[model samples]
Target: MHNDCIFAIQLYFMQPVTGFSKLSKSQKIDWLVTNHLNDNATARETLTQYWNEDQKLQDLHDGFSENTVTNYYFPFGLAPNFKIDGQLVTIPMAIEESSVVAAASKAAKFWMDRGGFKTVIKGTKKVGQVHLMYHGLSSEMDAFYAFAKAELLQSLEQINASMKKRGGGIVSLDLIDKTKNLKGYYQLHATFETKDAMGANFINTTLEQLATTFRLKASQFDGFSSDVPEVIMSILSNYVPECVVNVSVSCKIDEIGTINGVTGKEFARKFVQAVDIATVEPYRAVTHNKGIMNGIDAVVIATGNDFRAVEAGVHAYAARDGQYRSLTKARVENDTFIFEADFPLALGTVGGLTSLHPLSKLALQILENPSAEHLMKVTAVAGLAQNFAALHSLVTTGIQAGHMKMHLVNMLEQIGATDVEKDLLRKEYADKTPSFSALRESLLVLRS
Candidate 1:
């Protein structure tokens, strides 16, 4: 009978709960705890602990996503002393990684006296596409697309009315044929100037409308009476290579200053060598580029832009030359140290989470409420600063010393060390590397 009862309870929990989404927050938490958490009251308390004391604010956060339970938090840090384009700005970064904010901060101050980062906006035209298929003569399709170009663009005027008033709208809309690659595939490649908006929704909406107009017009066109092109999909492409920003930082080689007892010229030579290795070797390039993104992504997230989309677009841009290489370049010419980077950053200063999240609003405020172009320049500078810090550490006292030193406090907390014990161990391991096991043993010695 006891075994039978155990089977009944297991079977009961195995059955899926109906209308789970419709359940109240309290009911959902209760159900979760009862069914999966082994009735642990602490699990329920953990969820409630992260809730805001202000009910209205808590509700706003909950509505950001579906089936929301609790707010997952990240440390919001500021890296000050960033001078970009003759203006000083403190960048807001949201991340949990150790030593990232510190590295960026150090790099910013390191360059402040030498020369601040210089940034230029290369282009801001974003791209989208409408894909279609039609088993028809290539010549006929080409002529028909040419005829429809004006109408396709005109159809966007109403949709882009507000954007037009803001000096942003359609840049170009043209048909691209890909019949050789796919038997009947074609695309209506479109570009737009989104100005201060990231413009994913704007681009996608424009493409879908264009697709609708094209299919309707194709049904009536003389060349397509027999076979109208079939609309497959309309979406915005994250691979906006044309939308780019250029970031560069340079100063006299001799003025780079001594580092870890190495002369400025020697450090410059080693730094250029390290960047060169990453440029040619794929294995090292991946990590090198990742370090750059660590800075870019942190700012992107803190400002509430789509970091995932930025990541996808950035990695694609890196491999655009048919090979993955470091996104940054370094060279010493005429006794001057030069470093530069160019990459796409489709960021926005408005809309999405920027208008919704409180912290995101603060990030923009900290940035002095920059326009999209300025935001791009600021973010690219962050990436450059982060890379410089990493490479400087690599060619200096090494990465582990500072990185592990930053991790010491966390290690002490994990082992439940007292405040006094942590301070003592911190000094002892300040110049030395430590592992968890070694820390544990030493911790025991302190107690003994």
Candidate 2:
């Protein structure tokens, strides 16, 4: 009965048209032919228009005047069949490459057939830093903290009032004195529970407010000599202090055997090994980190998170071992492939063009109004799933087979293969090989 229930879940989510996993090369050709000849043109056009409208809105918000590099249009595809923890979710991703959406979708389907992915998220706390660079206050550090404590607390209270109604708010503050490079620099750390928002802009803005109040109070003090210390950088720490999200998945061997030669558990083990290599060595870590970012960057583009900030934080964290490491780790345990990804994700929820980009706003809405913390947790899970898909392909079929087949379309186009010629060549080369030399030879023969 448990097995039957699992089957039903898989059927509901994946809804794959093909029942048998194996097919002749001719059969695959035929399938492609049917999709091209009989596909829904009107539906495709509608989607194109939707994305165009989104692009226009993005342009307006970003202030693109035609010569700017701000407008980016990546391929937006939906991973249609995902049942994570018994809940169906259609993940929307904007990426330029092929295979990723399909790979993740198929993996999610396999997990669904076995048992589906389960997830947990830890408590949410955001950290903000205040740099106090005042001369001669080094000796009076204790007095300085005391002088600024009440007003800072009051500032947090006002910030928390709105948050308190939403079931979260500013919780605590920490202070540190003295720095090596910058003499007479004191740091006051503010830890706030940002709830679902990424709380970056929120936390930074709040810290700026407190810093202003502290500066005013410091001027009135007798021992304080430095000009109301101007805040150099006020922003939330990416090292999220709150407990983040956790997810786990299990898939049966028979279920995975449907796809190819290896068992699900074996694939899981190889994936773990690959990720482990990335964690320990810089040589493999670059590609491993790329795979993690492949997932994260797509999601960030979709939801309008500062992808650059995410990239910066992740790459910085990767180099923590004096060398870079993979942002994700994978393992096999108890008939399951366990994957985890944690890095500094300094995302903001409300501020900037997040409110400006219409499609970005739509992307956020599709995610069910996720808070900043919730978004990070979900981001981690998505990265894990994507990493698994990439490594599994690497270990099993050797990643290039499917990838190159898709690239053939581009290679043909690059050599100036027309639509008709491309389709004919693709059909002729059913084995999925791009014979550019052959095409050139054929062109010469036809001229003769």
What CA root-mean-square deviation does each model show from the true structure?
2.4, 16.5
- Candidate 2 pairs with clashing backbones: 196-371, 196-372, 197-371, 197-372, 198-372
Which residue ranges in model 2 land beyond 4 Å of their true spot? 1-59, 62-71, 134-139, 156-160, 178-182, 224-231, 239-243, 252-259, 263-266, 319-323, 334-337, 343-354, 368-374, 433-448
Full-model lDDT for every candidate: 0.91, 0.66
Worst 10 contiguous positions by lDDT, candidate 2: 62-71
| Candidate 1: residue 19 Cα off by (Å) | 1.7
Give lDDT tens digits, candidate 1, residues 1-448: 6955765687576878999999888888888877777677899999989989999999999889987878999999999999887788899999889899999999999989887999988999999989989888878888898788788878888999999999998888878889889999989988999999999889899999999899877876897644788999999999989889999999998788889999999999999999999999989999999999999999999999999999999999989999999999999999999999997999999898998999999999999999999999999999999999999999988988888888887888999999999988988787789879989998999999
TM-score each candidate.
0.95, 0.75
- For residue 60, what is the lDDT in candidate 2? 81
* Full-model lDDT, candidate 1: 0.91
